[model samples]
Target: MSVTIEILSGLGAKGPAAIVVEAQGKRLLLDAGGALHPDDTITWANNLDVDAVLISHDHIDHIGGVAELAENVPLYCTPLVAKALPHNRPWHPLPERGTLEVEGITVTTGQAGHSLGGVWLHLAVGNGVLYSGDACFESSVFPFDTPPKAAIALLDASYGSYDQPQAYCVQAISERLDQPLAFPVPETGRALEMALWLAKEADRRQLTLAIDPVIRDNLAALLALPATLRRPGLDHSIRSLLARQNACPPTLQLMCDRSDTPEQWPDHHLLHTGYLTPDRRAELAAGQISWQRWNVHLRASHLVALADQLGATQVVPLFTPFSDNALSAWHGLLGERLCTAQRLYAPSRLVTRSSLGSFACPQ
Candidate 1:
């Protein structure tokens, strides 16, 4: 049997995530992502049909478009991720780490090391296919699990060819923290890890710190999960930070992400740490705000490493600019294994059928 992969969106540029995989007369939708900005509209879900939809995480760009799909179509995601779905939407549980059968196909999941309950998906079809949904390897609290071998890999290339170490990024941000600053971040993503880091930094520098209640709640949720879900040795720090009280009229603050402007926080400058919307980019260009990356997505070197680890023969770099310079850099790094097509046919000698079996959940 042959497998066909189509990239409906999230290719050749930074946008919503959507992909369709077909094999053995069955179709599976990888992710139904919505627009990154409020003014933008998504058209990928119009008249879409599939046997099932598998969500990789709970981020808005990954699960926000679920309302557009027919309610009868089954959806699968981790229990934690299901919390972010539209109200009253039914969904089956995808293991945080284990194997299962979906639509007569073998599906395996593992930690993506980018968020609270995120997992990378591996499908058994045409040798094998892997999809890394907004993955990373340098998170201090999250753990990046090694994925199985595959012939094709759909990777998160949000950073394009920018290669910078996480330590360097932290030091750069540290240099600018002398003055009052407010960092708005995704409460479920980097906010949990950053809260712990900032708490330690505040103690060392003798500066007052404040954290949003929502972020504190997420940190509590992370602790409630199995110990293996997060990186070992950080439990103490997380607990201690949770015990501390929020500082009023603080020197620094970590709050939920929103359309924040410098003028709104007259006493503190806005410091952004993740994906910048078009409006934020404009502000950054005009020097109205400060921007620094905290390595929430895969960098250039880590992307190459993940491709090598998967033994992928055809790799599509998703969610990045496709400029000539960027393409040249990717070629230098990925060489012959690099694939830039929107549609791909990955062939293999192995059969595509697998006996259906009971599913296993992560311990």
Candidate 2:
């Protein structure tokens, strides 16, 4: 069973998100999303013959249009992601994991530790291809494992170029900690991670640590993640932590710089949102607060590590529009393993690079 993937749209296009996977005459679409591109083509709207749809996770980009897709296709994903689906019309069918047949092809999915219900896909017949839909190999939250024995691998290169840590960032923050300083970050996910790392380091070093009441709850959420975050695409750990909380305030704003008792927290982080207007930016900048923008996405160094781990006969980058620099960087790291991309869906020369000695696909 051979599968052909069509990258319909990505990264703030009119069509919010959707990828068509054709396998042995069967269609397995992933993420029927909102207007991904600026101009929504609705190319997927008319295709109803999809045997199954695998939702990578429940972020808006991946699950926003699930309800709309459910109107036409049979969907399959994690229960957590299924529950996370948002729809207004009512009585929409929820799709979860289960094996099935489509046009003589076998389809299966595995955990992809991006968010709740995140997953990677697999389809096989003669030469198999593994569809890695946004995955992180070296993550503090979770690391997804790769499948065995696949001819071609369609990987998620979202952070594929990530290969190094923010040494400067850590140094900057550490320097400020000596004095009363604020490390303002995103109110949601990555902020929690930073807080946790800080909290742990502070405890070990016996340094005074503090969380703004604004982000006390976010700190708590981060603390909770350690227990429940067994895999990707599900926040059951967070949900369980919330259940254990005897009492929690409605909000938290870590405005001060004093690390104290755990009870001093509320929830969430204090982010410097770009969505804020120019006036807001001015006000934030004027305010005596330290702002930091740190994300959990893999760095260029991490991508190099990823290539080393796979050690495949050939290495390729997909899902990235431009990656020559990243590829070159990986070339330095992987040496023989690193190779150019195999144009799965392009008009140009299909083969990008080959090793000193490699076998051509048996045609």
Candidate 3:
């Protein structure tokens, strides 16, 4: 076999985001994440032997098993993710768009637009393989490089054909905010985007925006990173939001914890944003709290379009398990190119010459 790809985990919500890529006499683990089974968290990554680990982001599901990796194994990630890792392993900071040759395999990183330091990988073995760690193409606050072309693409399909745009979700949340609004979001990832959007909204409406300690720190970290990772005016806007926090005005507050019970804070317009789980839906039903589902992963239409744009001959779905409806939607677009992760995809194709190109994000 010229190259073989096995989905060790990360097939569904319960699975961790881990895939083993074997080529050029090297076994590269895409992400050392752990799976969340019904009763317990399973360390499926422990079973895989790899030469190196490539982290897509710092999200728990994407980097949970990093600490478990042996110290000698090299861990590669973007500078932000490399710095954020809790482990003291040998971490290599991968330059965005810079190629790294490891054991004869060529790998490059590109902006993922999903989190503060997330990136997608373009691997050149025989044919190219692009692994998109949890990614988002609709982010207004984050900088997304153009999508790179590859023969095979392992993409994030968490939302599965749910095509609600970010603008719509932001507008929906904004419409309900007549008074002070509070959003309880994850410490990283989409939370940063939401904070920036809220800051912009506050500026537009001439209101004060307050950020909890966690968000305040995360914003600072994002600003401290190199300028290339950020879009222009993002730092300035975040700083402006911080400056207005001291003055009392109609504010949108960022709460890190669930202690900000909307039922008790009836005076404030509580707009809790996160994945709409059963518990969250119940909480919204129990009180006047409004829940808005913010999707950070690609929708079905975007996923298929991206695959076609990248010139992918084969596409593997990640994040959530694809339903029949989801598969049908992809089949309509990809036809034979869309392949679900039911078995190993070991291609016998030989290595073709690669001409590196970059993707330019929509303005």
Give the Cα lDDT of each candidate.
0.88, 0.47, 0.73
Show where candidate 3 strays beyond 4 Å: 12-14, 35-39, 246-251, 257-270, 276-278, 285-289, 346-363
- Listed in order, each prediction's TM-score against the native is 0.95, 0.58, 0.87
* Maximum-TM-score candidate: 1
**Per-residue CA lDDT of candidate 1, range 146-219, in tens?**
77778899999999998888889999989988999999999889998899989999999999999999999989
Off by over 4 Å in 1: 348-363
The clash tally of candidate 2 reads 45
Give the TM-score ranking, best first: 1, 3, 2
TM-score of 2: 0.58
The C-alpha RMSD of each candidate to the native structure, in angstroms, is: 3.9, 9.6, 3.1
Which 10-residue span in candidate 3 carries the lowest summed lDDT? 354-363
* Model 2 spans with C-alpha error above 4 angstroms: 11-17, 33-49, 67-70, 88-104, 166-195, 198-295, 301-363
Q: Pick the lDDT winner.
A: 1
What is candidate 2's lDDT per residue for 1-363, written digit by digit as tens? Answer: 344556555522222456676755566676766543333445445645576776766555556666665554556665555655554322223222323354445655554544434666655533454555665544444435444334444555554454445554455555544443334443433444454556545555555555544345643543444333433433644344334322223222224223222223323333331122344355457652234434344345544444443334444454444546655665675577554532233112122221111111111
**Residue 117 CA error for candidate 2 (Å)?**
3.1
